[model samples]
Target: MLKFFSEEIDFKLPFPQKTSKWIKTISESEGYNIISLNYIFCTDDYLLEINKQYLDHDYYTDIITFDNSEEEGKIESDIYVSVDRVKENAETFGADFEVEMRRVLIHGLLHLMDYTDTSEELKLQMRAKEDECLLLF
Candidate 1:
C-alpha cells in the first residue's frame, strides 16, 4: 500500500491514484513488491529535525528514506520528503514543480531498489533510472 501524510505543512499531493499506480509499476519492474510505503511531506525545518534526530545529520535534504523491508524482493519504507526543498529545487533546476515532485518520489523508491547516488557515475545512473520511470507516467 502507498500512503501520503504531511507534517508542519499544509499540502495535498497531486494525482494520488496515478502516482500510486506508477510507483507500483516502478517497483514491479525492479523485481520488488510493495509491502507498505508511506510518503511524508514536510517543511525544511521538520525534515532537518528528523535528520538530526534519526540520522544524526544536521542538514536539509530533499528526501530521507527509512527502509523496512524484511525479505528480498519486497519493499517497506517511510519516505520523508521536504516540500520546501522540492520547490526550491524546481526553481533552481528550471523544472516544473510536478515533474520535480515525481522525480523525488521515484528517487526514494529507487533507493529501496538498491540504487545509490554516492558517486558521480552512480548519480548519473540513478538520474537515468529516474527519467525512465518518469516516462512511464
Candidate 2:
C-alpha cells in the first residue's frame, strides 16, 4: 500500500493511483515487494524539526527515508519530503517542479532499495538511476 499525507502543508498529490502504480513497478523491478509505504509532505520547518528529533541532524533536506522492511525482497518505509525544499531545488536546478518532485520521490524509494550516495561516485550513480526511472514517468 502507498499512502500520502501532509504535515503543516496544504498540498495534494496530482495522481495518487498512477504514482502508486509507478512506485510499485519500480520496487518489483528491484526484486522487492511493497509492503506499505507512507509519503509525508511537509514544509521546510516541519521537516527540519523531524530531522533534528529523529536523526539529530539540524539541517534542511529534501527527503528523509525511514526503512522498515523486515524481510528480504520486501520494502516498507516512511518517506518525509519537504515541499519547500523541492520548490527551491527546482528553481536552483532550472527544472520543472513536477519533474523535480518525481525525482525526489524516486530517490527516496531508491534509498529503501539499498542505494547510497555518501560518495560522489555513488551520488552520480544514484542520479543516473533517478534519470532512468524518470523516463518511465
Error of 2 at 78 (Å): 0.5
Error of 2 at 53 (Å): 0.5
lDDT of 1 by residue, 6-114 (tens): 9989999999999999999989988999999999999999999999999999889999999999999999999999999999999999999999999999999999999
lDDT of 2 by residue, 1-137 (tens): 89999999999877878888998999999998989999999999999999999999999999999999999889889999999999999999999988899999999999999999999999999999999999997
TM-score of each: 0.98, 0.98
Q: What is the C-alpha lDDT of each candidate?
A: 0.97, 0.94
At residue 117, what lDDT does model 2 achieve? 98
CA shift of 11, model 1, Å = 0.6
